[model samples]
Target chain A: MHIPDGYLDLSIAAVMWVLTALVIGLSLKKVAESKNLNVPLLGVISAAIFAAQMLNWPIPGGTSAHFVGGALAGILLGPYAGSIAMASVVAIQAFLYGDGGLIALGANLWNMAVVNVFVGWYIYRLLERYSKFGAAFVAGWLGITTAAIFVGIEAGLSASFRYPAFVAISAMGVWHGVLGLIEGFITAGIVSYIHSSRPDLEETSNAVISKVPVAFIGVMILLSPVFAYLAEIVGYSEPLENVAEEIGLAEKQSYTGIFPDYTIPGVNEYIGTLISGAVGVVIFLSLAFMRQHASAD
Target chain B: MHLLIEKTVKSATSYFQDFFIHEYSRKTYLHDVHPSIKLLGTLAFIILSISTFQVKKILLILASVYVLALNTGLDVGVLAKRSSLFAIFSFLIVLPVSVFERDVVYLITFPLRVFASISSLQLFILTTRFSEILYGLKKLRIPGMMIDIIWLTYRYTISMFRDLLSILVAREARRLKKTSHIETLKGGSKSLGLFLLRSFEKAEEIELAMNARGRKISYRGKYRAGFFYILYISGVATWWMML
Candidate 1:
């Protein structure tokens, strides 16, 4: 779920914008490395994901979802470019289709695209090294969850920073955490099928682990504050549209209390653990996975 | 010319913000507002519309629509017709919700939430121009690289879609006659898979061309900034928040 502009404070919104920009900048440098790098093809994937999003599959909770596009891009194009590609899709959706709001670009990009890019690719690379099937399955699985966690973080961050609202980070985290697993299965199945048909392509792929790591780390550092600023903006207040009355859009308000409504179970704790586990796995696997791949080769 | 402009503006006003139909291009009162503002407006409206089951707020939202119809010069008849597409889809999914729940309040609230989202979205699409909206974002200093990928991807999408269509056609022709529905289904899927593989190769070539043209991710603007001034006239925007 891409939140709109003015959902968050300007300060937060500004921070997100900075992070998204940094990711894009770094992607370009990486793209320049190989002349044979496929632009239109990745572009096609972006477009298809954009179009496909219009067709959502039904999930439980009376909700429907389409492709996330981030993991798909990561698996196909590698991580850095993958992040940029997914962000571009969000941009087009914002500007052209208005699916995602212009202001929430930072949050959406950071959550849906950036986090997925680094986490998905790194995880996929590691998993495949040990067992191709395992890697593909995990890549697809985490790909879906990465966005869920990111969205949860975003919703959590937004609630904490901007407004004390109906849904907290924990609520969103649990909600999307369950929601994303469905996507993970679909993503894994698709990746496994594709990789099986073209396993050689993965090994020969231009994206070696070492080169990508440096780029992502550098980019992440520079963009973190920028993303923080953008999130602050969207999470905070923004000018209202030409409505006769002001709508209930307060970017960030001081939290009044723990939260009420939604008598869901240890909902918050479960979400917290889920996010923590995902991060732990991503960090642990990226290092251990890369080493395993290197040794296997 | 004046009559046509009036009619077009009217058509625009009536449509629930049909994103990126920049037929009017340069100027109209609505043209100058920041995209972020319109986005926030819609978000606020949707949230507000959903949070209440009161007839009063629904009427307010409806009134907002009427005002939109007046300001944008869209015909009430045409706008209502377009509005129903979303209605049809919403009703498709929601019919069951209302069917099973039966409780008036429960049925009503969720449907209204859907309606509010659909209508507010239409309002956004009708009012904003994609390129100008993008210009506004660029001015806001969103990354140059993301913008570049979007621009290139957009330019290439139509062609790629067309290419897939042709390949599908040729593949079908080579197979002589139509097969069982299931057979065609399997064949069709495999062909599309290959198309994806080829497209990956296609991206590499485009990247090469991009590099050859001296395009870097952070390349200084090759496009004129004159247009940004048109959208960024709210010179005090940055400080507007600070104050």
Candidate 2:
């Protein structure tokens, strides 16, 4: 799931960096405003998450899969604190172990820390009233699958990558979707155990997602396809390439370039790019953000 | 099943243990360079390498990185060996793309760039201590709170791993018979749940301990750029500009 450095173009990487920075900055403020911000607790929990990732669960076959715990972090801590914890873990993985690329750290953090945590938290909160265990299961399952979808979208969007958006999306989405079952189960089991034994620690988060944010997210989800269509109709290419064409350093290979043109074979470029981008956004923004009620207990 | 748990613990322990021990025991000239300079230099090299699609330029950067690694007393073979895992992964991932596009260049350029980038980062980590890197980040004006959290996270990761290893060992010791997959899942969840609770309690204890001592956590470092640091950065800059 860790996208190495060369896999992403500079432009995509920069966009991810900006988005990640924005989310982290907002998270920092949210965490600061909370009365019970425990820095040590956050750090230790981050460490535990990092180490616990080493624990593997047996799959149906003779193989094993490790837990990612992004959703678990959000469930245990609040979304804001959970993002920070996961960011620390991801950063350490890159710096210490070289498990991920340095240049791609921003994208890695965006997918795992921001997208995974928030989405998981949102899913869990939305479904909590129905069933705690089931909510956790879906949160854990969907959180990872969505993150993987983003990875595919990012890679697919990059001209440097060989695969188109759909192939990348399917490969990443399908594999993780299947793996997420185990993730879902483990997350639900752990959450259930903690809830039964230590209910005080179960509902650590008091964030209330009101109808307004839900409506806003719904609108965003609805608008993603429109946005993707409009961008494609405008013949979207790398920003730098636009500059290059303006300066006459590069010719306008709008329709013929491999992927810079954002053309999908068989289907029209607009529809292909639109479908890819829209699906990416729908999966992403569905649980990406939440509005906390000011008076929530 | 116990073998699986033991293998995971041993691997995790070695990763934490071998790194700190390897880093602390070495005192090369590169180790004396200012970490901020090294960090910036590393970022510059990585960006430069990946920015270009020229195989020649990428190879040049890789060679330069290898030469630097060898000069700094790092085993180039080990660094390359570690980085090759990512390179092979990159190659395999891009293989489908190259086959689809019928462009062999993608196969070489992507993996080569990944190798150079990983090698450059590993070189930086090899020469600089984790504390110095944090101090460098602090000097670079990253958030104080982020630095503190990252520091604490690094400090406690080992202790938490030890706790996990112990929990696994204890669980294994108590198991009187073979466990089913469901039982394994239950056991694993129990261990993780217990670990999380223990982590929260330890955090509370540490918070109190820190309050008794003081609240402020800061890293003070005298960052003096040596001749070697200057020369190294200049060389990297020259290479980047040349490309």
Candidate 3:
């Protein structure tokens, strides 16, 4: 769902960047407090979103399936952390999986992270005011659908600009519109199950926020290339083979050719592997530092 | 050879989109020109390029901008690669505009044109520095309030995220952090809720900071760029002149 760099027009992407920044600008203050609001719990939630996104499942009719990036993260982390968490996921996808380009990072960040967190959060909340489980169902559905439409329209826009002028953006929206229906339903089911079972999560989140630590910063400085090897292992591992089976999503990924066997080597691969390590380290250490400081102050 | 160059330029725009291309050896001259010049120049070209794309004019303006860009000391190879990424992203964003499905030329041109105009703006930012552009913006009266907010937000965001990471690290260390995978999940949900509450409070604090500093526009009326301002006004005039 991350629409990496070099995929769209520079001018259009610029507008999206400004818009994304505005949202983030507005979100910056709120996001900061979130650190103190949730605690170490944000880390675990980020990790879960990361892990879930990794396993691209299949839709029942046979296309590929990826996690509902914004919806799932938003439900747990709210919008701010959820947006960043999803951005982190896209970054890894670009570096480790070579899924999207770098320049397109802003666009991808906007479409996948921004849309998922903000758009999904609102839509989900709107549905949930009526029933407890309804929030999850709505969030998951809207999150994925919104992302899909964003991607499809972006494609049509690019095509019209590039070549035959008449080739409209909505031309492709039909495909995504259909996909959104299925995505919404599946996501709703998953969210309903998870949120319903874990009621404690709804309360007592802020107790976890705290200040950052020095040792963790040291870790970020020392970090480098281990994730590529890890990705390779993950790509070949059969343990996940059974995951889809359990969820009955074995059909989703198989149809779309989502799981491509990637060999991570060369210049870009080296950099990505190193950066992913650094990013992970940075986040972990940052968490450590915040926790210590939050308690002391 | 001119068409060859145009074709090459078109190809390069797409090239910028593949992987995140970085600034190559072209960094030697780094802003041998002023930041304000580069930013304004980039913005101007972005306008022309975007207009050309939307007008569906013979790609003449787009090609001319590309040709002009090629003459600069900046690394063409790297830029070519970088531009394409934004192009594709903008491409996708504009793609959905077709959702109106009516095939209105404005839907086709205006929105796409606006998007392209800004992608060029992004290119300017990446190529330039925040300080220089802020100087340009300040000189141009783009609104100090927005700019200051951008600066403060960055400081606070870094500080806050840094703080959050430390907290999570502590939880990891407690008791080998073996709170069952499920317990870990509980910890996460709690943290997110807390994070939201704090984020709201932080927003209020920032607002107070702005207010204490006196939240008035430094240039509310006519911009204060002296003679340089006249040239900028004319440049914008030239842009509208095309329309």
**Residues B60-109 of candidate 2: C-alpha lDDT, one tens digit per residue:** 67876776666556678878877899899889988886888898988889
lDDT of 2: 0.75
- Writing each residue's lDDT as its tens digit, candidate 2 over A115-200 gives 78888988998999999899999999999998888888877876667687899889999999999888888888888888888888
lDDT of each: 0.51, 0.75, 0.44
DockQ, structure candidate 3: 0.01
Q: Give the per-residue lDDT of model 3 (tens digit) for B84-186.
A: 5544555455555545454555344544443344334444544444444455556665434334433333234334543444444454456352353334334
Position A288, candidate 2: lDDT: 28
Selected candidate, larger lDDT, 1 vs 3:
1
Q: Compared with the true structure, what per-residue lDDT tens digits does model 3 show for residues A29-138? A: 45555544332234334444443333333334433443445765665566665665566556444432334544345566666777666666667666777864566656
**lDDT for residue B119 in candidate 2, whole number 0-100:** 87
Instruction: For each candidate, give its TM-score against the true structure.
Output: 0.56, 0.83, 0.41
Ranking by TM-score: 2, 1, 3
Give lDDT: candidate 2, residue A115.
Answer: 77
lDDT of 1 at A117: 63
* Per-residue lDDT of candidate 1, residues A1-297 (tens digit): 666432344456557667666666666677656553545445666765553333234444534444465665777667766776787777776655545444456777777777766666767776776875566556655666656555545544542222232344455557656755544554555555567587665543444446655555646744564455455455443223212123212113342221213111233656634543443344334334322322111
- Candidate 2 Cα errors over 4 Å, as ranges: A207-297, B1-4, B226-243
